[model samples]
Structure formats: C-alpha cells, structure tokens
Target: MHQEPDFLHNLHQELRDGRRWLDRSIVLAYAAAAGLCVVAFTLMADAGFELFQRIYRWQGGWAVLLWLPAITVAAVWATRRWAPGAAGSGIPQVMVTLDPAVSEHQRSRFVSLWLSFSKMALASAGFAAGLSIGREGPSVQVAAGVMHSARRWLGPHSGISSHALLVAGGAAGIAAAFNAPLAGVVFAIEELSRKLESRSSGLIIAAIVLAGLMGVSAFGNLSYFGRIRVPSLTWNALLPGLCVALASGVLGGLFAKVMAASLTSPAERMNRWRARFPLRFAAGGALVIAVIGLVTGGATFGAGSEAVKHMLAGEADVPSFYVTLKFVATWLSAWVGVPGGIFAPSLSIGAGVGHNVATLTGSDSIAPALIAMGMAAFLAAVTQAPLTAFIIVMEMVDGHAMVLSLMASAMLASLISRMLARPLYETLAHHMASALPGPASTQDPPEPAHAPGVPQQK
Candidate 1:
C-alpha cells in the first residue's frame, strides 16, 4: 500500500488541482472581457450620439426619416449577404448556438461570434442613422459572442466552463451599458441565461463588478438617465400609483400584442417579397420620412431621447398626437425588417403616456414617477420579464426609492401582458424560426465540439 501510494487517488487529486487552476483562469478571463465590453459600448454610444447630431445639423429634420430607409436597406442587405442568422435581435441567434436545431454547420462558435459582431455594427449604424433603438440588447449579444470566441481560442477544452464565461460576458455587457452591476447580474440570471449555478454565480459577479468599474472609470460614473429624485412617499399616493400601474400594465400588454401581431404578419408577407427586400425597405424608409414630416415636424423620428428629456425638463407638453405618431412610426420602422431594438422606443412611449396621464391629473411632479413606473410596467408587460424590467427602469432612471412601485408595476404588467399575448422575444423567435427550413434540410458547417449550453427561454 505504501509503495503503490494509491495511484487512482493521486490521479484524482491532480485532476482536482487542474480544475481549480482552470477555474481561476476562466474568472480572470471573464473580468478582462467584461472590462473591454464596458469600454467598447461606452465609447460607441458617445460617438454614435455625436455622429447623429452632426447628421441632424447637416440634413435638417428630414435626416431622421431618411435614416429609417437607409438603415433598413443596409441592415437587410448586410443580413442577407454576410450573415442571415443576424437578421433580428442577436438574442435569437445566441439561442440557436446553444440549441443547434438547424445542424452542425450552423453551430460553429465562429459563426455565432461573427454574426453577432455584424449585427452589433449594423444596429449601431441604425442607431446613428437616427432610428429609435437601443444598444443594450445588441451589446449583450456582442459581448457573449466575444467571450465565446475567446473561450474557443484560449480554452478550447473548457466547453462547459465556457458557457459560464458566456453568461459572465453578457452580464458584464449589461452592467457596462447601464453602469449597474447588481441589475446586470440580475438580468443575466433572470432574463438572458435563465439559470444560475453556484460556480457560475461567482463568475457572473466578478464580470459584472469589473465591467461596472471599467464603465465608471471610463465614463466618470454617470448613470444612463443621470439622476431622478422621487418625491416624498405618502399613503395617499399608493392608491393612485396602483391605479396608474394597473392602467400602464393593461396598455403595455395591448401594445406588446399589437406589435407582435404586426411584426409576424408582415414578416410572413415579406417571404413572398424577399427578392425585393431593398426596394421594400427603401419604400418603408420613405414612409417613415413622410410620417415624421407630417406628424412631428420632423422631431419624433429618432431614438426620442431628446423628446424624453424635453418632457422631463418641463419644456414641452407631450400631446397624445405625438405619442400616437411616435408609436406608429416606431411600429412601422421595426416591422419593415430594420435591425433595431424596442427598448428605447418603449421608454419613449412610456414617457409620453406618463406625461399624458400627468397632464390629465394636473400633476407635474407625479409625471416623472409615473413615467418611471410606466416604463418598467410596459416593458415588463411586453418583455414578460418583471425582474429585468424592474431592474432596467431602476438603472435607467437611477430611481432606487421607486423600486417598490416599480416592482408592483412590473409584476402587474407582466401578468396582464401574459394574459393578452405571448412574451415578446418568444413570439418573435417562434415566428422567425418557424419560417426557416427544418434542421434536416439545412445542416450547419463542421465545427469544434462545443458544449451546448442551456438555452435561455423568455
């Protein structure tokens, strides 16, 4: 016994030591990747804002409308030519990487990463073109893709471990984008990855903290919406707040249903007109332009952040007509096959709706609170992720005090929306994937044997 020294035991001990070292290395890699994503997104967002401002100065109000058509055409062309998988929100594509329903050919980590990058670029371009979209979701996809690539290159043997890193990167992306580490971690757990293991939790935390620190160091610790102070809470206000929350939830549900229905029907129609995508997009762009020209005097075409600011600053009266116009414009722009996101536009709509309610109630002070609540509520309703929605609004507005109301609103909205329709991402993914050829007919290219991570369901 002494001579043999338990050979199997010695081997097991060595393997355990190796695994510990690998885990440490993976954590370090996650931290670095998270930092990089924070810097990239911050710089990109700042530069994108400046570019849009320049375009506005040069082309006048007409620039906003022109952006819709131009970006739609470009995004459509790029998707069809370079990476068809990147056509929509990169979330669906990421899901495919994990599920591999198509075939081995489509399951390459390289394809996932490349398609994600292309989509990120296109989405950024679309935003710079003055389309009403947000970079957060795209950023999440891009970060995950980058981490996937890194794992493939540096830790090829760590397939299962790499999934942890992918989640870490995604969390870091959200943290970097919003400068809210806790919210980012929660989002990764609740929305993107949909699962949390003990080991992965530590990795996610490290990534989020590092990414948030990087964002703060680079951008001077600025919140996405600056600071929003809530008024004193009162027992009397609770009832009104509840009523507002209920209404917002119902409306949010209805909005999500309408958008999903519109998107699915038109996308189906597009199958027949796939050959003329460019022209169709161009025509759609022209329509966007005309809508802006007529309704907003050319003001409501872009991300509507400026409009939100105006409403918040008490500089403008948010009329129903404007809300309706923005709603229609964003709906059409998204429906017409443009590579954009719904977050910003949804916030804009929420703000407008909140302002309208405030005017009706003759209370300016309550508007901001209502706006925050409505933003979360409506988003929760549409996305069907109450926790994510609540955290997103909290981070977006820097409203910690309103967390309770935000939670209430979000839950109500999610419940109502569920009753009205399916979750936004799920519906979109299902409709899009259903149209594609079956896995048997379309096999993915050969690739490394990456572990299929758990798929995130909405």
Candidate 2:
C-alpha cells in the first residue's frame, strides 16, 4: 500500500479533535443562551408586575382608562414601526418560522435578536399598562432568538441544526418561565418542534436543565400556580370535573374561534375595521378592558394572577361575570395586537370558570380538581394541544394524582374545540406561511476567494 503523508495524517487527527471540541462548545453555547433567557425573562416579568402594582395602588381603575389608550397606541406603534415581527403571541412566529416552506430570510425577519429585544421591551410595557397578556409566550420568542443567533455566530462550527436550536430555545423558555421542565419537554415534542429528533435529546435536556436551574436560583422552586394539595377524587368530584371541562371547552372554543376570526385579513368587517383604523380600534379594546377592570374590581387585569390564585384556593369572592370579562379582555388584547401572551391568562380564565362550576353545583370539596380540569380543558381547547395542556397543568400545580382526570379533560376539550375552531397557533402559522415572500433560489452562490482587501484569482 502507498504510504500516507505524515502531514495529511496529522491534519486528519486535528480535524477529528476539532470536531469533538465544537460539539462540546455547541452544548455550552446552548446552555448559556438558555440561562441568559431565564434571567432576563424573570426580571422582565417582575418589573412589569411592579409597574402595574404601583400604578394601580396610586389611582386604581381610572388609571387604566387614562393610561391604557395611550399605552396601547404607543405599544402598537412601537410594535408596528420597530418590530412588527414581535407583535401578538410569539409562539405563532416561532411555529411559522419552523415551517419548511418559509425561507431562511423570512424566518430571520421575525426571529432576530433585534426583534427579540423589541419583544421583551414592548411586552413588558404592555404588561405594565395592564394589557391582558402574559410574559410566557414572549419569553419563548426571546429564547429562540438567542439560540437562532448562535447558529450565525458559530458559523460552520455550530454543530447544531437551526431547527433544533429553535425548538430547544422555545422548550427551554417554557421550562424556565413556568418552572416546569417536563412540560417544556412535552411542549417541544407535542407543539413547538412537533417531533423530538433522537439526535437532539441531550441538547434539549441541557438547555432545559440550565434554564431550569437559572429560574430556580432566581425564583426558587415554587410551582407557577403554587402547590395544590388535591385530595383523593370521589365520584362526587367526577360530576364537577365534567361540568368544568364541558364549560371550559365550549367557552374556550368560542374564544379561540372569535380570536382567530379577529386576526384574519381585512375581508371580514371586524378585521377590516381594525385594519382601516388600527389605533382607534386598539384604543376601543383598551377602553373595554378598563371598563371591565372597573366593574370587576380589577379582577380581569394583569394576567389575572391574583384572582386565579384566590379562586384556586377557594377564597376569591370574584364577581360571577369575571370569567367572561377575562375572556373578552384576552380576545381584545389579541385583536389589538399587543405583545404579551394568553398562556397565563387562559389558565386564570379556566380557574374562574371552574369556580363558577363549583358554585353552580354547590360543591367546594371538588373545587381544586375542577379548577385543575378547567385549566387543562380550556388550554387544550384553545391550543388544540391536549398533551401539552394537561402536562403543563400537571406540572404547574404538582397534581400528578389527577393526571388521568386532566388528560380526559384535555382530550374532550380538544375535540370540542376543533369542532368550534381551528387550532389557534396552527391557523396563525398557516396565515404567516401564506403571507411570506416567495422562496429564494436553491443554487448556492460563488464563494469568496479571499479576505476583503485581498485580490481575487483571474
């Protein structure tokens, strides 16, 4: 056999070592991105909460009427002018970017670091103004941007698939935002990526672990909705569970349908009006929310966190109309193109609905179970992602014992929701994909031969 050159053999060995190093480096980069996202998102959420708390304390509901319209106009203008890509719940943007039909350029248009920063700032501002949105969805977009940008930074040495980074970033974001790692995993598999590639298993886990640790360090190991000590379910619990599920499913389905309808292009009268005069329409939505806040004693404000907790603990004396008010607020926020999310508020709505169910049935003992089911059911109805809905609720409330109940509610609600509306994210994603520019040519461009100052070969 011909002798191999020593230089060639050494180069080969070096290449293999470099490949191994790059692989390890990619993992570190992913973990770092996840950790950074968790910290930034936590601070963003806390700051938004503090802003609303202080403003409300100073003037209460009247402040919303005064501030919300101006805030909505500024926020809407900011989102449209500076970061149109960051508008609305960001999960749809991620989902749209992941579609195979969308070109890299189109994906980058919406998921860049610039847009991510805009999302964080605008979304926090919306929260501060008591927009009925959540921090969770925007966090997903921000985290995904961190990882997506990593692909550009690492160049050929990234050793990470672009799609994988998007999925991992979103998964890790959910894990950190709600302190629910398992739900993150399930969300990645069931919704974000729609498939868990075997090759990416370790990478996804690393990001989740890093983000989860960061969240724990900052917020401690408390459940997003606090731990609910659900007692053993009796036959009595079943009736209320069914009632809550049916109500949440039907109502959540209608909410999804109306929301999707509102987001459509200007062919529809409602969407046309919103299109013809966006600022005015947006202000109207804000005004409606302010009026609801005034009527509900602000129960419908700020993602409904306090009201949900109170209702879940069976201590809230919230108005009978609060659930409807919250659902309408969420719908209006979606229509007005605010930068926050429905994820947190949706659960709160479900909890409120469940409390109503308990009241109607005259059963306090099963309130916790009913509330848990309502969360699973309504979220499932809205997103049409049953597994994600149940797993998230199970993780959030630490109600592992009610897993079966939650799952049943999720399935039933999803089925019922599909009857009323297309999957919310999926419909939005389809619209996004349809609206994107045509794909670029597949042929590769010629490579540069030298650095900027160097001459090219003749």
Candidate 3:
C-alpha cells in the first residue's frame, strides 16, 4: 500500500471530530426545544388545575357538572378533527410512534408539533373540565412531538428518526414532568425503550438535564408530594406491606383488564355503545364521572392529587369509596377518546387502597409505610415497570428509607399485574399502533379505530 502521510490522517481525524461535535450541537438544539416545550406543557397543565379551581370556587358542583359535557365534546371533536392520536394518556402514542417500524405519516400523526400542541390544549381542557386525568402522561407525547418536530424542522431528512431522539424526548419529558431525573432515566430503560442504545447515552442525559431544569425554573423546587415519615421498619413491615402490595396490584390489574376489554370486544357492551355512538359513549363516561363526583362530593373530579396529598399528610382521610370511584373516573377518562392520563389518578387510587388497608386492618402503627407501598404497587401494576414505579414513589414523597418495602411491593404488584392483563400502556399502545396511518402525507388519514361499529376511514 502507498504510504499515507500523517497530514492526510490528521485531516481525516479532524473531519470525524467535527462531525461528532456537530451531532452533539444538534442534540443540544433538540434538547433546548424539548425543554422549552415541557415548560409550556407545565404551564398548560397548571391552567387546567386553575380552571377547575376557578370553576369550583365560582359555582361549585353545578359548574363542574355543566363544564364536563362541553369540555368532553369539544376535546373529542378537536382531537379527532385535528389530532386523533392526542387522545388518552399520551404515553401510548409516544411508545407506538417511537417504534422504527412506524411510518412517516403515522409518526407525525402520533408525535408531531401539531400533536404536541393539541395534546397540551386538549389535555388542559380536560383537566379544567373536571376530568379524572393527569398531565404527566400527556407530557411524554408532547415532548416527543416537540423533539420530533424539531428534527423535521432541522431538515426533511435530518435523521432524527434514524437516531434515538424519540427515546431521549420521552426520558426528558418524564424528568421534566415529574422533577425526578433518576426516575426518568429508569423509566426510559425499564418502560420506554426497554433497551439502551450506547450511541445515545449522552443525548439522553443532556435532554433529561435540560428539561428538568426547565421544570425547576418554572415550578421552583417543589415536591410532587411532601416528605413522609415512614416508620422505621420493624419485623412488622412485611405483613402490612404485603397486604398493601397485593391489594393495590390486584386492583390495578383489574382496572387495566376492564379498560382493555372495554375497547377490545365487539360483543362487549362498551364496544356496542362506542361503535354506534362514539360521542354518546364519551358523554356516558362523563356522566358516570359526574354522578360519581356528585355522590363523592366532587372527590372523583380532577387528578385526585389533593386527596392523595391530604392522606400522606395525615390531615384528612380518603373517602370510603375513593379507590373504587377513582378507578371508575380513570377508566372513564381512558374510555373516552380524550387527551388525558391515569398516572396521577392511579397514584391517588393507590393511596386510597393503602388507606383502606390500614383502616381495615387497623394497622395505624405502620400506616404510612402501607400507604407508600400502595402507591408503589398500584403504579407498578398500571405501568408494569416495578423499578420505575417504586423509584417514582420514593422520589415523590422523599421516602428513601422505605425503598426495600416499596421495591418488594412494586415487584409483587407488577408480577400480579402481568398475570391479570397486558401492561396498561402497552395494550393502549397496540391500539394506537394499529390506528397509525401510512406514509402518504404529512397528515395522517382517518385512523382505524377499534370501536366496534365505527368504520375505518382512508
């Protein structure tokens, strides 16, 4: 071989190094955009809580009841008209869109700038309307949309999809939404991608950091839930922890089963109602929530955050049927084709379960631990990512001391959840994946809905 001079080798090395730096710069740009989007999303979600509060303060029960139908109808109409994939906890949409197997049009439909904006607007509307939903799940899809759209803006073929930007966006979204970067990292590994791409490690971390900063800047350093005093684990930790875990897990699993079933079987009543009358079906859900709210003194409305916090503070008791009501509310929100999430609703529900266990078992000695365990287990059951679940609960309440108890509870819950049904988000993702349109246009054609009587459109 002819001798290659050092100068030529040096020039080649320089070009390679320059490309790497350029790639990183591009990622930084993506992170900046994603972080800003999360900031906007946080504000939008806050607007929802504010709206609910304002309405509640102004007119109380009647106002919320009146707002529900209108918001649901508008949210559904706008989402279907402009962004069908925006419906439900946006996590499933992000999950399906992240799949390399998805087409360009489908990806845009599920995770795009338009979808991100639509998710924020509609989800916020749902919250303000007193729907039992959370903003965190929607934030995942919204962040994915922001990053993906930024990639498209970077260039027609900026290779955004070819890289791990979607993965990074999802992880960053969780970090921003929850203010828990470690949980976000764990969520990415255990839930979103379920595998790490060595090339994208730096990209993922940078995105998470930037987004988390945006959150901190906007909200200040607030805990999702204040620190709790978990009793020092005596040999007594096992029994109550187990009780909470098993109960939370089983209940969570059952909730998932009902939801999945409601959308799956054409012969099922939910299918019949949704197929022939989509709008009516959503109205029915709204009605159920409203009635529940009325019966529960409006406890069933919103994301149930206040109630959960109250319980954790030991300042107020969870209502007797709160777990059951919260489940129904969450289930109804999922059933309706609306932009919302069950994460907070699920946590509140888990809190209710734990409180009930402590009360029923009369285990006041370790009540707080049981409650912590319930939150971990229930979240695990819904998400089917025990480590992520427990980590999130641990972070929310600053309950690091209860890690072992939470871990055991979370794992047990997830295992039981696995046995009862498909993971909630994954099953929802399956539905969303099928609904993705082919790559014929930037906008997707009408989705292929699984609702029994609803006809698919081209």
Candidate 4:
C-alpha cells in the first residue's frame, strides 16, 4: 500500500501556493503540448514522404533542373514579399524574435504563421523536386509556429508560456524527422534555444520522448539510416581515424568560411550595386542548377539522404570525384535561395570524403569509423556545436561504441572552424537579413554569454 504525505508536504503547502500552482500548471501544459506536437509531426512526415514520392514519379529528371528552380523562385518571392525573416534556415528568425531590438510590429503572430506555412510548403516542394535540403530545420520552424499560434486561445499570458512549448515543439519536430530523440533534445538546447534552464530542459525532454514514442509507433524503431554497422574497433586503426577526423574538421571549417563569404560578399556587393533583386536571385538559381547538373550528374539534388545511405553502405565507388561533386552541389544549393537544411548534405559530403580517404589508403577496417568521425567533425566545425554534432551522429547511427572517437573529432573540428571564422548559419543570416530593405535590423541582439555564436535576448 502507498503511504500518505507527511509533515513535509503540509509545510510545503503553508509555504506558498501561487508559485507552486503556477509551476505545476506549466509542467502539465507543457506535457500536453509536447504530446500534441509529436502526433502532428508524425503525420506531417508521413504525408510529406508520400507527397514527395508522387512528385518524383511524375516529374522525372526535369524535377531537379526545372521544377526546383520554379519552386525556389516562388518560395523566395513569398519570403521576400511577406516574411523576409524566414528567408534562410528560420533559426535566425527565431533569434530575431527573441531580440529586444525587434519592435512589436515586426513580431506579429501572423508573420510567424505565414513564414511557417511558406517554409513548410516550399521545403516540402523542394524535397519532392529532389533539391539538396533536409526537412529538420524547416520542421523546427513549423512546429514552433504551430505552438505559437495556439497561444491565442490559451490567453494573453500564453505567449510567455508558448516560449517553452515552442522549444518543445522544435525538439519534437527534430526527433520526428530524424528519429533521434536525444539528439533532438540536445539540438534544441545547443543549437536553437541555447538555454539549459530547468523549465526549458524539462519541456524539451518531454517533447523528445513523446515524439520518439510517436515516431516508433508510426514508423517503427529504426535509425534514420537504418542499422549502420561499424566494424570492431582496434588499436591499429586509431591513428588513421584520428587523422581523418582532423582533416575533415579542417575542411569543414573551410566550408563554413566559404558559405559565410558567399553570403556576406553578395550583401556587400548589393550595397554597392543596388541590383534588381528578382533578377539577381533568378541568376543565382540558374547558376545553381547548371552547377548541380555538371558536377553531380544530377545525383546531388534534393536531400541527398539516398546518396548518404549509399555511401554508408559502401555501394558507391566513384573516388574523390564523388566527394567533390557533393561539395559543389551543396554549396550551390545554399548559394541559391533554396529553403532547406544543410545537415544531411554535410553528412553526405563527410562520408564521401571519408570513403575516398579509405579507398586511397586501402584501409577498409577503419573506413566506417572514419566516415562516422568525419560526419561529426565536419558538422561540429560548420555549426560550431561540437557536443550536439557528436550526439546527433551517435543517435542517428546508434553507434554508442564510437563515442570516444566522435568526441575527439568534434572537438578538433569545432576548434579549427572557430579559428577560421564565425559559425556559418549566424554569419550568413546576419548579413542576409541586413541586406533586405525595410525596418528590420541587421545587428544581432546581445545573446547570453554562454550561448553559441550570437545570443538572442529575451
């Protein structure tokens, strides 16, 4: 039999009621919100995949070259016309929302909702047309927007409460998209929210768990890439793995620098030229399509998840040419105004690099380890979130045994990238947002000292 509460409980009630009740209600509300988010994301992913399959069957090769450009133009135009803040990864918009400098007029609920829908529709269409982008980033924005919209019915104070739920929804979306619960939670903390307060942590964790459960129930308990088997670890392979990690990290840093330079240079140029915006964007789109066709033979278009799986399975034997193609494709995709996430493409690039290195060295034993390490290293370098990168890969591959090497690689890559320059997303967003006309401010608000890159003030 259960025992009743004792004198301590009675004393607690005597201490305070308002704070205690509010805390309890917040926890309960968050739990409910997280559960709802999980259900929504699961449905969305299934629908998105089906829609993409149908589009692929209908479009054929022109999917990448023609349809992608058209959709990209529409999406870009919609963002520029209605929701300029949603132009890029959407993370920056979230940062801007939290910025104190942003006036109330700019932070309208309608803007968030419109941006969310546009991102979802455009990202979904991009995936359907085989563009090199992932769904995770867009999903985060969509989910957060959904939570934010729900605040209207929950009362005025719901906006304040929605912040926590927004983080939760984002975590749920990531978990559902990638089937990585821990990574979702870690990412929400490390990359997006950049806060570890108890309220936030509790909500995010709750959301991740609910989303994971929903994903398993609907999609089965499978890693994003299925079962990635790593050969048994050995001391002899350690040196080569380390070397691969170091190289990938350095290269990843250079990649981040390249993206930042591309984004910022264009902004600087725009200031000088004051060029026609649509014409410039269209030209960039055309260039991206041409480069993708030339370099990848059209293989690098879209999310590149299939290509990544092929690399992991050791099915592709194209040599360094393959990695080079992917790198170019990814760069072009980003350089153009395609609304998508780089995480998957980055992983594919890393895998190709690792696979090429292994082939050159004839070190089959260490190839898998190197591939995994390369992914962590490159991602850490680009995003400047070493721990999040490590955990994300570990969760995606379910490779707990590879943790030590992943950690080492992530640290090396993140350090090298930091030495090279700022985190890619922040730098790109800052410049791009600034270049746009209107009342929007370009300067980032004072972020928490501990927050990665730039902090968004509450």
The candidate scoring highest on TM-score is 2
Whichever of 1 and 4 has more lDDT, that candidate is 1
Candidate RMSDs in Å, in order, are 6.4, 9.4, 6.6, 5.0
- The 0-to-1 C-alpha lDDT of every candidate, in the order given, reads 0.65, 0.79, 0.77, 0.64
Decreasing TM-score order of the candidates: 2, 3, 1, 4
Residues 248-276, candidate 3: write the lDDT tens digits: 88998898888778765678876887878
Model 1: per-residue Cα lDDT over 1-458, one tens digit each: 44858889988895887755685576667566656764775466557656866766665545645654665577667766776665555554454444436454544522355755676667766666566566666666666666666564444444345556667767777777667777778877766567766755765677677877877787777666766768886675675566666766677777778777766665565534644555575466546654563456545655677677777666664456676777766666565554556766777777777777767776677667877787787777767778878888888778899888888888877777777776666556555555556662253322221111224442
List ranges where model 4 is wrong by over 4 Å. 1-64, 100-104, 109-111, 153-162, 270-275, 283-287, 317-319, 429-458
Q: Once superposed on the true structure, which residue ranges of model 2 sit more than 4 Å away at CA?
A: 1-16, 155-159, 440-458
- Collision count for each candidate, in order: 4, 1, 0, 4
Model 1 — which ten-residue stretch has the worst lDDT?
445-454
Query: Tens digit of lDDT per residue, candidate 2, span 279-391?
Result: 88888988888788778887787887778778778798789988888898888887898788889889989888888888899978878888888888998888877887898
User: lDDT tens digits, residues 1-458, model 4?
Assistant: 99887888888884666554454355445444544454454355346545645554554544445555666666566656766555455555554444344454555522256666676666665555455666666666665665555445444432245556566666666676677778878877776666755644654576567755766666678877766778887787777777777777777888888877765674566423423576356446544754564355555656566666776777864436766666766765665665667788788777776777777778776677778887888888778888878888888778788888888888777877777767776665455446444555556523312323444333
For every model shown, what is its TM-score relative to the native structure? 0.82, 0.90, 0.88, 0.81
Kindly report the root-mean-square deviation of model 4 from the true structure over all alpha carbons: 5.0
